[model samples]
Target: MFRTEISMLAACALAGAAHGQNLADLSLDQLSRIEVTSVGKRLQRVADVAGSVYVITADDIRRCGATTLPEVLRLAPNLQVARVDGAQYAISARTGTDLLANKMLVLVDGRTVYSPLFSGVFWEAIEMPLDDIERIEVLSGSGGTLYGSNAFHGVINIVTRSAGETAGTLVKGAVGTSERFVTLRHGAASDAGAFRVFAKKRDAENTQRASGAPVRDASRHQLAGFRWDGGTPQRQFTGTGEVYHHRTEDVLGERDYHGAYVLGRYIEDAGGRRTQLQAYADRLVRERSRTIRNTVDTLDLELQQQQLPTAGMDLLWGAGWRLYRDDAQPASPAALDLLPRRKYLHLWNAFAQVEMEGAAASRFTLGLKAEHNAYTGLELLPTLRYSWRPSEDSNVWAAASRVVRTPARVDRDVASPPLVPNPSVRAEKADIAELGWRGRFGSGASASLTAFAHRFGQLRSFDLNGATGVFANNYGGWLRGLEGWAEWFPAQNLRLKAGMLLQHPRYDAAAGTSPQPPSVTLGNDARHLFKLGVAWDVRHNVWVDFHVRHVGRRPAPAVPSYLAADARVAWRPAPSVELSAAVRNLGEPRHVEWGAPATASLVPRSLLLQFVWWP
Candidate 1:
């Protein structure tokens, strides 16, 4: 499955350029111009967000030396991304779980991608041309105020660029010692609107040699889409759609999935008032080596309004709903009476946030979200925050929020005798409180830091009997951590970015914890993790980046400690062609994250070479 015959190639002209100024030369004023919608779903500078967040742009993805979505996720300060063999990855932030992972809600274009089967984002199947991403917003801790449900620990928003913004003809392909990747992007504009379509394919042999080694992970994506803009920016309507497919090798067997989706939204602003409506539906098929297969279809809709009903106060509100269904395989007449499956269960939610501006240097925010789920019934999430800015250089803020982890389909099905259901499971709950600081110095540097803790109740896990797929209540646990990050680009060419994180988790009763091995340090969580990277511009058109990272160890999980680093150099040989090469995991064994001791890791040292042509 070679996308291109790979061979050693020198860095393109971008990396060949002579170095005079480094990325560190860029001042604070310059970096503030990058547009971000991660915080409030509105354009604002990165510094405006009240919590610890990171923005990974398309360029950053290329320059960071990564191949898959999991690799890109590693850039987040304390987030852990560990590969389970070739296709599966155990990913989590701050807190780790044994039976079920119910933290971290992941969204693609505002659509929830976590499976109701386990309350975790299947990190796999998030296939899209990396080049199409506008930016990735990583928000840590209790985003339940807006995202609802499993947004217990953190939130990841993967936003794509508009077809209109990417109008052009581009082809990008890559080759590596053990893998190959390629993508094609083309766009056009007409009276109806601007449209762009792209396709990507990747195949890789095992980096490590062994039968059943979890290598040979292969996947492909076919997406054809267009955005039709019908009116002005303030009053506009747009639509887009895509079809995609993905296949991966896993521990049990391979799972192939194919799907299509279409989305449309309309916005209107009149008399200082604004309103919006959006809807989308997607269908996916899951085919496993086993005889049983499943098909899932999801439908989503949203409506929102924002206005200043009274002076000095701003009000924003929105409601959303999602319907999900998984059709089971047809059975013989004898088994027709087995547990029946339903095609739909409505989840309806509404939220409103009010921001009050106070005189002098203070502001206040009050918000709440209410949702009704068939499994866990009604849930209410609330948030309260206050901020004060004494001077242009600094601002301090604090917030308290309540979040819940709604029960998933797995909570009921998979009993020991097979399809029997468990009716006693309940939702996991959490209470979070945090304080943060944002500051900018006249000397041209800025930073953000957040200190937070979470109290959990009714955590779910497999029953001690372990006889059924059913899960039951586990005693409460606690998570506390500190996250801080900063970016300094003194110049356009040279940039320095760094992040640090620390966390500790305490289980109230060590007795009944199922899979945790005896070696785990009591109450000891993952230790300190750190990240540092520097991007330098060398001469004419050459740019080079070096990144180094450290992953600490933790309990029950035999996750080994490791230090790994990656380096990349890119050159623009011509205005239309660029060449690049990168190396990953230079100094460590195959690694993984957020899994029980049984989780496997299948990775070896690897290399990647790619070419980009934009005309």
Candidate 2:
């Protein structure tokens, strides 16, 4: 049974790392550190965060039992997840250069999760409850001077915490051999503040090497929220609500979905000057055989005042209004407007950031972003970053930005069959540059390395709409890449992490040159990748972990590259009881990338056994 749940979580992390060091506690690599918030926009520490960041917590998603969310986002190795069927998923970061808007930019607790009707991001309608998340700040490239428009290839901020930091009431369950699960979480606090709720259910039936294609996977998710850091935790007011549903097995059968969203946030900081507010509402519906419905209502309100009447300089501005609707009824009624078409998207953005601390350690950051979109209305995204810490653990940062990618609904309107619509489209822009260097040696662990170059202009592909339909992005392309990462704790119970990525993409000659299977560089890129992980402790209440991933190998439009390994263990024994077991694709070779062909096979090995109870 998956190696007996990874040998009973390695005998409960070596019986709690043999008391790590009596008289108190502090094992697990000395309680670990180096948090993140995807660089710029707050939450630092990753060696002071000068760029290129990464953080995934919640105890690394329960020691990596992964169960979805693209397997905990493929444990970030510069990200590049694929599985295009059965609840679809296709995450990207770094290269293949975000086909017509791949340029990453996602948010869950902060709203904004792709989809303007195909800017894409339906990662199975996001259920995120991976233990009520509390971190996930992956930021590799541009953020348009602080998140403004399709971030241009890097920015993943999925933050969720506060419920008084998981008050109480918890439960967990699991099954293996292809996958099965159960989850629940609850929390509470008094003084009119703090609350939490979570739920999860999943079913599995993997293994279907094709025979008319079938995987029939099942999925379910739920979440609830409430918070009242109540003025003083730097002023606050937060609210959240989420709902999701899933169904798999496509082609004439399974293809169901359900979605719901609600969000409200307000945070204010007086002495340090900081203010913010956000609003959201989303609804989605999809069913088998051509029934699609989408609704979006968002009001992102922002206001910032920092280092205000003092310090160096900093300011943030915002204004948003998005209202989208999609009916898409297609049972063939002369194809009424051929379905899929509803527009009411509006956006207006304002940004400003200036932090200059000249001489000595040097520091300079000037930012600006102005946007107006409703299908290319107005735009001006600008930003520049400069840093030079020279010493104090080293630091060096460089940045340049201007990004945009708007126009979905199949780029204006799609009608299945082949593709359609092109409402005079024009919304594809990229001009990016980034350089990074972050450090923290002295055996404390921390490292970073970044390199980027983007220069795109109006890129989209697919055409010829009548004779049976077809129309999407009549062609355009160009991309580039390079990435690096590191983390180490040398001794003290271990803690290691590593990453690497390199890519190249093209076909800008208007993509003419005839066709045969040309989508230029094919469905985003995945050049070369490498990832490694190790987390020990192996003693005291137990804890054991290991991860290894490698995905590389490509041609014009064919992907096949593999390597996988995962293992986990955890045990608490008392004090509310806790137990864990994990094993995923351990040595289960065969791999492929880019989704949709029933997720392109090769996913075997799976197991999980969990139990939790709280005080």
Candidate 3:
């Protein structure tokens, strides 16, 4: 398998070089100038942000041959991504990875997608057409001051293209050793605006346990969505809706899940001031042969404004409200259950940020947020940041922040035996400090580096109160890490990217108690990680890409260190047709990224062929 992949890569690279015509869409300098809106809730250049961030462009996603959002996220070096099974993944930034990682916040076109029940994203429920994605901005640091609560560790914002940009018909199909999928999209232009509708279906085979026994984790998914873009630049309006269904098999039984959502937004820009309002409603349902069955309905509304309040000063403020009504039922009397079968959860938050320019191209920013939740009445989050531009292509930044991870329904409502709920549970807290630098070396290279230290308190731990095992806050710890990535344009048509991360963490009991596995597990992390990637647009219509990653061993549960590689070759035979072949997990037939080795599911190697057409 390794030899075959290498031969294919060699041939593609030679062919592309012989037929090369133009450089990739954007140059190194142009990439630095790309505007992003997640760092500070306002548009800013990548080189100007005072945080640790990485941007994955549309071209990068296309060349990587990743059919799903989770797969695409692996391209960002700032994140730790693990394939748990055939249809499940564990992803986190600057923290431990888990099946239900709640520290990271995810947004699709500015709409929150995290679940209220677990305070984590259901990756299986997010089934959007990948072809419409414009870009993804990944920030590997706390965003609580502006995003609030669950935005404790990091944030991922997915931006999609407008209807006008996809005004045509598109069809895509892919078949692999273990999976198959098909998608269709159609768009049209109108006097008022443009509109598009799309649908997709996918099926995946089951993964296997260490003993070669099938895990029965196969899955199927179907999704449909529509979007409309209207109005002018100064006063724009947009609306979107989506419906999806997914089914999967587990060791215990089979499960079916479905959901639908609709969202609308209006933005007005007057001179140097901007105002935006958005609203959305969503419903989700789950049915299972075992475990629990549940339904959740959500309503959310938000308003924000940005203005140049004075000379060399900018102001940004926002407010939001969200409500969730959840109903749950257990499959059996002995199964786990949430008390008060029916419950309502409400969240309210308001935030403000001020940025002022100082002497010698320096800038200072202060932000604060006050948030209230059903479990925790009110909490305050604050951040202070400063940046100095020593040159046109270099920036030095530092920041200090205090944030908290509010309790989720699962944290305080479980009413099953062997596990007792604690309604008085307090929020987990963190105090962080960071120093970073970003620089562009001419048009051929660019780089970013950041060092961070986080002090944690009131961490969740399992406590034996008399005879009952109650969830409690009895642990504390500290984490310090260094992360950085660099990009180089070795040639007009060839680009190379490399990144690395190194960290050290320590944990202990609050005082007299001994350290528990649950407390140490809070920072179950890899000591170091490294990644390298190559993208060569050999020709005007041919491309070759390769990615290699190395993860150090993890403690506690003990996940062995491993190195993996992926390669892809694509060619456009005509103006409207393209074909690609890719291989994942090259050389390594199977490996486990999470769970105990004896019970962990193995991720298998796969070879795939894909076709895309625009007619």
Off by over 4 Å in 1: 1-27, 33-35, 97-100, 190-192, 207-227, 308-310, 330-338, 416-420, 466-469, 490-492, 509-525, 589-599
TM-score of 2: 0.32
lDDT of 2 by residue, 1-615 (tens): 000011233224322322222212323233224345455675445555666777675566667768777689878777777664345666777764333335578886667777666666767656655766655777766775567777767778876666766777777777777666677777777776777777777766645543445455444444344433333456667777767677665555566667677777776667766667677777777655544444544445555444553465555445555566655555553443434344566676766666666687877777777777777787777777788888877688888777777666665676555444557867767787878887667645666778777777665555553455443334455557778877776766767888888867665535553322434422555678888988787775677888988787555346667788889887788867777788876885434444333345546566778776765
Report residue 449 deviation for candidate 2 (angstroms): 20
Give the winner by TM-score: 2 or 3: 3
Name the top TM-score candidate.
3
lDDT of each: 0.67, 0.63, 0.83
Query: Tens-digit lDDT track for model 1 on 1-615?
Result: 000001111111112121112344335654444445444444445555555567676656767767778788888885756565555666666775322345788877666777766677656666667776656778777778778887887888887665665668879888997678788888876666667777777776643332334444554444455445456656766676778777776444677777788888787878777787888888877666553455778898988777845777878888999888866563332332113554456789998888888877887888899998878789999988777788866778788999998877656654334234667878888898889997776754677788989898876655444543445556577878888877775665667778888887665643655633212311224567888888888855677988888768755555666678888888888877888899877776454443443434446667899888987
Kindly report the root-mean-square deviation of model 1 from the true structure over all alpha carbons: 6.5
Error of 2 at 253 (Å): 8.6
RMSD of each: 6.5, 23.1, 5.9
Q: Per-residue lDDT tens digits of candidate 3, residues 83-198?
A: 88777887889785777887889998888888877788878667778888767889888889989888888889888877876788989999999889999999998879989999
Q: Against the true structure, candidate 2 has what lDDT?
A: 0.63
Regions of candidate 3 where Cα sits further than 4 Å from its true position: 1-22, 519-523
Worst 10 residues of 2 by lDDT: 1-10
Model 1, 254: alpha-carbon shift in Å?
A: 1.4
